[model samples]
Target: MTKDFKVIDEYYEAGRKALKSYVTGFVLAIFLTLVPYFMVVNHALTAQNLVWAVVLLGVLQFLVQVVFFLHLSRNSRSHWNIIVFIFTVLIVAILVAGSLWIMYHLNYNTMSDSPFNTNEGYIPQ
Candidate 1:
């Protein structure tokens, strides 16, 4: 085949692969979203189990977006890209977890039911 034809064929193949990846990602993302939504709406799982299930599905959706949408393949050329992505994820996780921890502590400490709350709903007339 001519050089021009070869380049065109490669471009066509890449486009096909990208379209497939996007469709698959979209389907998986929808399934993940619907599963959690239904689980919550139908009370399919207990509260603790529901929370875990939703979290697991959310993580799966995140991974699907990363792999299919971001196209972060494990090719040698993209090694640095993968490393940078991992670092970003780690930093985000750390920030989220730390913030949640701080918020939980703050809420627990200041809640009306806490032992530190001495007023006990007493009112002065």
Candidate 2:
């Protein structure tokens, strides 16, 4: 009996295509990233618009980079890749939330009674 299995050239070709696509997308994303900077310098975008534009495009660019470059899928490692992805997301969420919580506590809630309040650093007038 002869084996009918073929070698995996498809993945090579697919990987090349994916790499090309990722590079193109990364270039485009870089261009988009520069837009807000230019707009802010020229006074074309307001502060709010500039920030929102950068944030939205940053998210989009991140997804693009992940999808094309990372090639994450349900089939990968029999779905273990998804588990890793989930873990990474959880870590990022926790980091962001923890930072915010700590900053809020140290800045406002916990410092509410400090002697550095208001009357300790002034002079006479």
Candidate 3:
């Protein structure tokens, strides 16, 4: 048997209001995303510049959405919740970094010139 606290209804109300308050921000984030995507496809931005622009803007927009919609501020979470969030973020960072490192080394390792490489092997004819 679970006990339903009286504050549950208030929590639900706050969640609803927060969601409603951020609809405009959500729409703007989507618009910003599509604007850069279309700009790149149209050749308005060079490939290298577009890559950095997209990465920075994507990260910026993600942070904006998180802050404005999720209300994640210094006081938002209790100590336990903050610790959990930090742990989860660290795990995600490790996973992404490790995957990138392995992938980069694999590509680097496979690029060396070697006689055993099938394309460079001796002709049998």
Can you write out model 3's per-residue Cα lDDT over 19-91, one digit (the tens) per residue?
7758866887888788788878897887888888888888878777766665565364456776787798899
Candidate 1 has a TM-score of 0.76
| Every candidate's CA RMSD | 5.7, 6.1, 7.9
Clashing pairs in 2: none
Per-residue lDDT over 1-125 for candidate 1, one digit per residue giving the tens place of the 0 to 100 score: 69999999999999998999999999999999999999999999999999999999999999999889988983588899999989998999999999988866665555454456455343222
Instruction: Quote the lDDT for 113 in model 1.
Output: 42
Off by over 4 Å in 3: 1-21, 74-79, 111-125
What's the alpha carbon RMSD for model 3? 7.9
lDDT of 2 at 65: 66
Task: Quote the positional error of residue 40 for candidate 1 in Å.
Answer: 0.6
List TM-score per model, in order: 0.76, 0.62, 0.61
* Tens-place lDDT digits, model 2, residues 1-104: 12322335666777788778778877877876787667768877778887887788778877766665676641457487778888999999899999987766
Q: Of the pair 1 and 2, which is ahead by lDDT? A: 1
Model 1 lDDT at residue 77: 89
Task: Please report, in order, the local distance difference test score of every candidate based on alpha carbons.
Answer: 0.85, 0.69, 0.73
Better structure of 2 and 3 per TM-score = 2
Q: Of the candidates numbered 2 and 3, which has the greater lDDT value? A: 3
For model 3, name the residue pairs that clash. Answer: none
